[model samples]
Structures are given as structure tokens and as C-alpha cells.
Target: MTAPAIRTGRAGPEGGSRRLILDMAARLLRSGGYHQTSLREIAEAVGIRKASLYHHFASKEELVEAVVNDGVRFVDEAVAAALAAAAQAGPRQRLEAAIAAHLAALHGHGDYTSAAIKVFTFGSGPVPESVRLSRRLYEDVWRGLLAELREAGGIAPGRSPEALRLFLLGALNGSIDWYRPERFDIAALSREFAALVAPNGVDAAK
Candidate 1:
């Protein structure tokens, strides 16, 4: 059988096709996890021949790599957009907006976003270094934000910034298992998190 038509250079339609391939790859990988999804599965989902994927990705790993990369960029843009929209807000508000955007970016909005939530095998077997770097860069963005909050006195006095960062990030990451749009609004969750980590506000009430 003739392989499905694919544009190699992504001049126009080929570029669209390339995006389709990436989107399909992200979905399949997000649903089945990286190891479970194969090039054949992705191609089948795209209604293309398995070999046709070669026109886009060199191998399954490459496609998965791209998915993770897309996920990183997706979250990065979200946080940046949140910060941009709140340029005039105080550090506390900016931090809250960033937290909300972070959760929104991870709320299974799409395969790329979902992939960021579920894919965590970086710096280990099968995961690439580039993926790890991208993930780290995202983490650094959070770190920088938290640093700003600490410097601005939004974080409680004498609180270990490093420890607080770990707790907040871990709490946010854990939402992947339990967070649901129907049950809890992303905005509320963000507000709650921001308050919880904000010095003596949420914790003091507790």
C-alpha cells in the first residue's frame, strides 16, 4: 500500500499535516502513556500509514520528545500570559495569577497539557536530556516567581523559601490525580493554593 501523503518540508499543507501528527501523537501518548503508544498507533489515529510518520518524526522517541517539548512550551506560555495580564498587580496577585495559570495549563486541557502532568520520567531511562532541560526550565520559571514573592514579602517571614517551593509545587502537581473541573474550579483551586502558601494567611486559618 502507498504510504499516506505527507509534506516533508512543511511548506503549507505539510505544516498543517505536521501539526496534526504532533497533536495525534500528544493525544495517544497522553492517553496510553509514552511506552504504550507506538508510531503505528499514532499513524492509525491520524488515518495515515505507519511509514508516513517518517515524513514528520524520525522515530517514536522523537515524536514523544516533541510532545513533551510542546507540553513545556504550553505551560510556559500560560504562566507568561498570566504574568503579562497582571503586570500592574502586586507580587501577591501576580503569584496567584501564575499559580492559577499553572494549574490551568495542567488541567488536561489537551494532550500536550495533560502530557506535562503525567509524563515525569525525565533524567532517567528512555527520557531525553532535552526533555529534562525543558522541564527544568519550566521549574526555573516557578522558582523565579517564588523568589520574587519572597523578596516582595508575600511569603511569610522566616519561612524556608526552598521548602515552600517544594511543598507548593508538589501540592499543585498532586492535583493531577484528584482535580476535576466539574468538582473544583481551576480559579478557586489556584486561589486556595496561593493563600495556603502565602505566609500566614491560609495556614494561620488552619
Candidate 2:
């Protein structure tokens, strides 16, 4: 896929400069893991100096946090929207919609997803509590959905909602390691994953 268009200048009509830096940083993080990404490189990508870049972000760690936080927020919002949209739909429909929305966000927000996953699964050292909390919030959103499905008798009663929630999340998030949107559309892949976790092959049609 073509690289996302890069914008420049100091916060344009819609606060563009700050967004440009974040976008550049996110792209860099996606192409090269967090360890290899640097503020200087982000600045250079935005056609600015490293010193000027610090004007927006206090340090590399801060920038990393910002990128991660933004990603988490984006995901949280997507989940909320999906759940709201699928409120009237059946459990399987809700779950599929939620998963598809998440995958789309991950695909479009590649940089944030890459950084968030890297920091979450294999961080170098102690991450800021805020980062951990943000990750938890994202997980909780999924767990909440699973709980709703359980209440609706969508999943088998014998299985723990928490366990099933983890299973679903593990399967969905694991896609980042291997998923190529060009090869598999979000809807088709999410449906396949949802079916894998459905109890007793419930609603295979979904």
C-alpha cells in the first residue's frame, strides 16, 4: 500500500502541525519498531529541526506516550461506536461489528497500533502507569461487550465470560502480527474469528 500522505507546517487550519508530527511519528513507528524510531527522525520527516520538535513533545518518552494514548483513545471510540451501532443487532452481529471496527482502526492507524502493541507485549522496561491503564481500558471495552453477549445468551453459559473475552481478544489482537488487509478484508476475517469463538458453532451464518 502507498504510504499515507505527509503534511507539514505548524498546526494548520485544524491544528495541522501537531497532527503532522504525530502522523509522521506513527508512520515511522509502523515501518520501524519503537526502538528504531526517534524524535529527530520525526522532525526531519516533518521538515523541522529536532529542537523545534521538542516544542510540542517534552521528550521521546512523552511522544511515545502521546502516540499510544491517541491510539488507545481512537480504539476506545471505535468500540463505543460499534457497540452503539450494533445495540439492536444479535450477539454475533455485535461482536462481528466490534471486531471489524477495531481491525479497520488498526489498519488505518498503523503507527499507533504498532507502537501500542510493541509497548504492550514486549516493552524494554517499566512503562508509565498511564500506558498500562490505557491498555487495560481498551481491553475492558471488549470485555464489556462479551459480558453483554453472555447476558443475551449468545455464548454458552458453561464458559466464563472473562475467559471467552480473553480468547476473543487474543485472537483479534494476534492478527496484527500477520494480517494483511490487501489479502483479507476486515469483515471477512472478523467473521471468521468470531465464528472460531462462537459456542457450539452458534450462528455460523454470521
Candidate 3:
């Protein structure tokens, strides 16, 4: 059976109070590590009583899972858009465009990216297998793009596409920790990153 569909956009009340709780939980998870974040804090952040928080999420672990699931959904959408664009363009152009799209999503959706990084890098205890699988699917999106680029000769011939993919992914994903829009724009940075890894090794136009 297919996995349950991950929720996106503004989850309405049909998603119920649980949706509100998850939103607040996601924010807290972004600002603080899982251990540092508390249900009480999430409730307060939502302007609800601590007891009411349980009505939505049973425990901290459950809340964390929701946060991860939500984040994965956000990333999936971004990657999907990039892939769609890549399909219509040459490898080099597509890679550059895809990187720009990814960077735009990351910089524009700071809270989502922050929560995703926290869950992926340092979650408390063992995460549920479902959550792990969701994260894997998220990573696979980039891997697929990199593979397509390599097969199309967009990437250099001698380099390991897998290694280059990992490096690019690491740099792109790690931007969540230090990226500041005020200091540098997303498009410029995306171009710079793409140029650094381009097969010709030439700097991308500013």
C-alpha cells in the first residue's frame, strides 16, 4: 500500500486541532532542537493550554514525526517543480534552473527547512521507520536529478556523479544553518554553487 499522503499548505480544522498543534510544534522544532523543545512551549506558542496539546499529539515523539512529515512534503514539492523544469531543458540549463528553484524554496521557506534539518541531523532517540523512509524519499529526489544530469553528460566525465551529487546536496542543504537573505540573494548563490560544480568549471555569470 502507498504511504499516507503528507499534508501541505494551511491544514484546515478538518486536520483539526492536531494541525494547529503541529504548526506550533514545527516552529519550536525549528527554533530549538527536539530535546530543547517542549509540548508546553508548543502549546504556549499556539496560545493553548498545555493539557490541550495532548488532545492533538500524544507525545513529543509524535509531534516530531508530524514535523518531519510536514517538512518532507515541502521539500518534495520543491524538488518536483525543479524536476519538471529540468525535463524541458538541456542538462546544464536544467541543473542551473533546478538549483535556483531549490535555493528559492529553501530561502523562502526557512521554517520548513529548519525543521527538516533538525529532524534529519539530530532527532531524539530512534525515529520511527516511517519518518526515516520519508526522509530517504526526500533525498532520493535530488539523487534522481543528479543521475539524469550525469547520464546526459551535463556533469564532468571523470568525476563520480554520486560523490558530486552528495557534495552539492550537502552544500545546498547545509545552507539552512547559515543562509541569510539579507546578506546574499538566493539566485546569485544558486548560480555560484552551480558554477562551482559545472563540468567546465567556469564561474557562472553574475
Candidate 4:
């Protein structure tokens, strides 16, 4: 099933009150973490009354569920689109395409993606089941991609698909903290990472 599209642009007044609230919520959640963010803060950020937030989301958890899901959906769709574009390409090429797409989406939609990661990673409170499910679904996409690469012998012989997937995603996601657009290009970063993990060990051709 197709997930709802995440608003990638600024949510002006015409963008619908709900979307504007989501945009602000994601930004706050990204900057302040889940616990540090509040419904009143999100409402204020969106220039709406705190009571207005309830009209869209019954509680803070419900609002967070939406933001977290949107975050995963945005990257999942980006990677899916990139893979479809490279459907006829070789496994290595396809992997590179996926990497580039993931990085682009990660940095391009930093607020949503970063908030999702930080909320999931550091939140000490209970997480909604739907939010966990959404994350698992997105991770499955990478698992499938890595499984394909392993089948094609693109991964080292001794490496497990799950291990490689975790490592790759961890490294990629961690870039949100240190990646500098002026210092590095997403395409180059993707190629460099792909080469590092390629079976042949630093195969520029791959």
C-alpha cells in the first residue's frame, strides 16, 4: 500500500492547518527530542492555539506517530523510486542508487527523518505500536536490498545480510550529525560507502 505523502515544502496557511502543525511538530521534535517537545510548543510554532492541536491530534503521542511515520515514508518512497529507476541495472548499481537516494532523502528531509531517528533511538517513554510498525516496515526495505546484494555476491562471503544492513544504516543515519553539504556531495558519499562495503574490497568499478 502507498503511504501518505510527506509535505516536503513549506506548509503555508493554505497548506492546511494539519500539515502546518505536522511541519512544526517535526521541527521541534527534531531539535528537542520527543520528551522535550510539547503540544503547546508545536501549536505555538504553528501559530495555532494549543486547543487547536487537539482538533487534529487527540494527544501528543498521536501527533508523534504521524511525524515518525511520515519520516520513514519519505525515505522509503525515495529509495523505492530510485530502485525502480535502476530496475534494469546490476545489483551493485542498484545498491549505489539506493544509497544515493537514502542519503539525499535523509539530508533533504532532515527534520522529519532526524526526528524519527532521535525519537525512536532515545525516547525512554512508551512508543506507539503503529510507530514501531512503520519503522519496521521501512527497515524491511533495506533488508530486502541487502539480501539481493548478498545473493549477487556483492557483500563479503562471511558477512550476514542483517549485520551488513544494520551497519550500513547506522553509518548512513549517523551522517545526520556531521555531514556537511559544502564539504561532501551525496553522490560521492554514496559511492565511497558502496565501495567500502563492496565484496571486492574497494572496487572503484563497482
lDDT of 4 at 10: 44
TM-score of 4: 0.86
Cα RMSD (Å) between model 4 and the true structure? Answer: 5.1
Q: Choose the strongest candidate by TM-score.
A: 4
Model 3 poorest 10 in a row by lDDT: 197-206
State the lDDT of candidate 2 residue by residue for 1-206, as single tens digits.
58455544545534468777888887887667678887779999999899987888888888878888887788778878998987777777888888888887787645677667655555677778888898888888888778867766677768887888877777677777888868888889888877766644443343
Runs of candidate 1 exceeding 4 Å displacement:
1-14, 121-126, 200-206
**Prediction 4 global C-alpha lDDT:** 0.82
70-91 per-residue lDDT for model 4 (tens digits): 9988888989999999888777
Expressed as tens digits, the lDDT of each residue in 1-49 for candidate 1 is: 5867744663564548778888888888766776677888888988889
lDDT of each: 0.78, 0.77, 0.73, 0.82
Ranking of predictions according to lDDT: 4, 1, 2, 3
lDDT of 3 by residue, 1-206 (tens): 58455554444524456666777787788878787888789889887789876766678787788788777777778767876866656656667777777677666754665686776674457778887898788778777767876766567778887788788878887887788889988778877887777756322321
Q: Write down the TM-score of every candidate.
A: 0.85, 0.85, 0.82, 0.86
List candidate 4 stretches off by more than 4 Å: 1-15, 199-206
> Of 2 and 4, which scores higher on lDDT?
4
Pick the winner on TM-score between candidates 2 and 4. 4
Candidate 2 contains a number of clashing pairs equal to: 3
Instruction: Please give the range of 10 consecutive residues that has the lowest summed lDDT in model 2.
Output: 197-206
Against the true structure, candidate 1 reaches a TM-score of 0.85
